[model samples]
Target: MRRTWLATAALALAAALLVAGCSGQPLSEREKGTGVGTLLGAGTGAIIGAAVGHPAAGAAIGGALGAGGGYVVGNSLQNRQAENQQTQGQLQQQQQEIENQRQQIEQMRQQQETE
Candidate 1:
C-alpha cells in the first residue's frame, strides 16, 4: 500500500513537470487560462470518478470538455485583444494625421505673412 501511494505521488509529480516543461515561450493570457481550466477540470474529474469507481473515464471526459470550453473562452479573449490593438493603431494614425495637418497650416500662415 505504501509503495502504491509513493508511485502515485511520483506519477503526479511527473505529470506536473511535463506540463510545466512543455513550453519555452511564455503563454498568452488566453492560453494560460485554457491550460489552467484543463488542469483543474481533470483533477476534479479524477476525484469524482474515483468516488464512483471509474476515475480514468471520468478524467478523460472531463478533460476533453474542459479543454474545449477553455479554448473557446481563450480564443474570444484573444480576439478582443487583437481588436483593441487595432483600435489603438488607428488612433495613433489619426493623431499623426492631425499633427501633419497642423504643421501644414503653420506653413501656410508663414507663407502668407511673408507675402
Candidate 2:
C-alpha cells in the first residue's frame, strides 16, 4: 500500500516537472494539450492500476496514449490558427493596396485640376 502511494506521488511529481520544464517559452496549443493530457492520463491510470495491481504499467500506457491524442487535437487547432492568420494577412495586404490606389487616383485628380 505504501509502495503504491509512493509510486503515484512520484508519477504526479514527474508529470508536474515535465510541464514546468516547458515554462521557459509560451506554450502553443499543442504543447499545452499534450501536457494536460499526460498529467490527467497518468493520474487516472495510476488509480485504475492500483485496483489491478499494476499502477506503473497503467501510468505508462495511459500517458503515451494521452500524449498521442493530445498531439493530434493540438495539431489540428494549430493548423486552423495558422490558416486564420494567413487569411488575415492577405486581407490586410489587400486593404493596403486599395488605399494606395485611392491615393494615386487622388494625386491624378489634383494634377488635372491644377492643369
Candidate 3:
C-alpha cells in the first residue's frame, strides 16, 4: 500500500512538472492566445477527442480558436480606448452645458430682483 502511494505521488509530481515545463516558456501575444486556446480547446477537445480517439487534435483546434480570440481581444481593447476618449469629450460637453444653464438661471434671478 505504501509503495502504491509512493508511485502515485511520483506520477502526480511528474505530471505537474510536465505541465509546468510546457507553460514555463515566455508568451508572445499570439503564443499566449494559442496556449489559452489550447487549454480551452482541450477541455472541449477531451470530450470530442475521446469520441474521436485523439485529444491532441482537439487541443490543436482549440489553439487555433485561442489565437483568433486573442487577436480579437487586442483589437477590442484598442477600440475601447478610442471610444473612451470620445465618451470623455461628450461628458465634458454635457458638463459645460449644465454650467451654462446654471449661470443663465442666476442671471435671470438677479434681473427679477432688480425689477
Candidate 4:
C-alpha cells in the first residue's frame, strides 16, 4: 500500500512538472507564479495527505489554494505594471509640453529683439 501511494504521488508530481514546462511561449509573470504555486502546493498536499492516507484529497485542496493565491498575486503585479506605464506616459507628455513652452518663449524673445 505504501509503495503504491508513493508511486502515485511521484506520477502526479511528474505530470504537473510536464504541464508546467510544455508551454512554448513565455509565461506571463502571473502565469509563471501560478504554475509554480500550484506545483508546490500539490506536492506539499500530497505529502501531507499520504501521511493521513488521503493523498488525492490533499493534492486537490492544495492545488486550489495555490492557484487562488497565484491569481491574486498575478493580478496585483499586472496592475502595478499598468500603473507604471501610465506614469511614464504622463511624464513624456509633460516633457513635451515643457519643450513647447520653451520654444514659444524663445520665439517671443526673438520678436522683441527685432522690434
Instruction: Identify the candidate with maximal lDDT.
Output: 2
Q: Residue-wise lDDT of candidate 2 within 35-62, one digit each (tens)?
A: 7787777768768887898887777777
lDDT of 1 at 73: 84
Which of the two, 3 or 4, has more TM-score? 4
Candidates in order: C-alpha RMSD to true structure: 4.1, 3.3, 9.4, 3.3
Candidate 3: list runs displaced more than 4 Å: 1-38, 73-85, 108-112
* lDDT of every predicted structure (CA atoms): 0.74, 0.79, 0.62, 0.78
Query: What lDDT tens digits, residue by residue, belong to model 3 across residues 2-100?
Result: 345434544664475467657968544444444455456545754576578765555456545655776676556656767898999999999999999
- Candidate 4 residue-wise lDDT, 1-115, digit = tens: 6457556765876686577678676666677667767777777887888799888788777877877787778777878988999999999999999999999999999999999
Clashes of 4: 0
As for TM-score, the candidate ahead, 2 or 4, is 4
Where is model 3 poorest over a 10-residue stretch in terms of lDDT?
26-35
User: For every model shown, what is its TM-score relative to the native structure?
Assistant: 0.72, 0.71, 0.45, 0.72
Error of 1 at 34 (Å): 2.9
